[model samples]
Target: MATDSQLATWEVFIQSKPGANYIHAGSVHASDKQMALQNARDTYTRRGEGTSIWAVPTSEIAASNPDDNDMFFDPANDKMYRMPTFYVMPEGAKAI
Candidate 1:
């Protein structure tokens, strides 16, 4: 019997244009940073859609827990400055 030993997992981000923020494209498995970059490019930018690529180790990314939403994000609801009612839009302005 044979089993596959997967390489390190990398999260791929692609920038569609110069100066644009990188958006998550997909993931790739590679042995190292250089290999990860190559894998990301070939897998995600085949049509030359991306101007830049970022390949970050999946283990290195930090994410917030959804279960702690009230503790983390609800405080903004109590802050008066966050209310749009505090500002008046000009008469000719359209609703955003």
Candidate 2:
């Protein structure tokens, strides 16, 4: 029921805990940024459930094209240390 100018889609992410990544809670449809924020609050934070919110326009999120990912990250393999699979934990060390 929204006109083209009035319809906006925002991807909502919520921080559920400290030192945690913002989780993709869901999306919201609203007339503008303010409304989207309020809607996100009602929908995702009704119970004080999150520590933060991020509402990025769905259209503004640029992702690596799947076909291009190979060319993009393949060079990173030259730095194997960037991956930690080989770092064994000291026998008694606990994960931070």
Candidate 3:
């Protein structure tokens, strides 16, 4: 059996309402999926602030390095044509 210090870390996400996007809430440490889920709910939803909770293992998440921001995101900066700035609105057209 794994000790408390050796337990896996799970990232927690909370949904405030139905059909709303889940936002990163925090993390919890647990030995298994069920434990992780329960820990997340108990830790983050004590005030009934969340409608739903998702607990994902920390090892399963992939993230980009902050140092690579220019190389990874700079290509989109020069593509001004991708934006719809030149379209003329029709007369009496409702705002979209």
**Residue 96 miss distance in model 2 (angstroms):** 7.2
Put down candidate 2 lDDT per residue, 1-96, tens digits, no spaces: 746675788999999978678999999988778888888989999998898888888899987898997899888979977877797778986753
TM-score of each: 0.74, 0.64, 0.74
Best by lDDT: 1
Residue-wise C-alpha lDDT for candidate 3, range 11-82, written one tens digit per residue: 999999997789999899999999998999899999988999999999999989999999999988999998
Cα deviation of 15 in candidate 3 (Å)? 0.8
Better of 2 and 3 by TM-score: 3
Candidate 1 residue 34 C-alpha distance from true site, Å: 0.6
lDDT of model 2 at position 65: 95
* Per-candidate count of clashing residue pairs (backbone under 3 Å): 0, 0, 0
1-96 per-residue lDDT for model 1 (tens digits): 655379879999999998778999999999999999999999999998899999999999998999999999999988898777777787886733
lDDT of 2 at 17: 77
**What is the Cα-based lDDT of residue 62 in candidate 3?**
99
Give the Cα error of residue 31 in candidate 3, in Å: 0.8
What is the C-alpha local distance difference test score of candidate 2?
0.86
Which stretches of candidate 2 lie above 4 Å from their native place? 1-6, 67-82, 90-96
The lDDT for every candidate, in the order shown, is 0.91, 0.86, 0.91
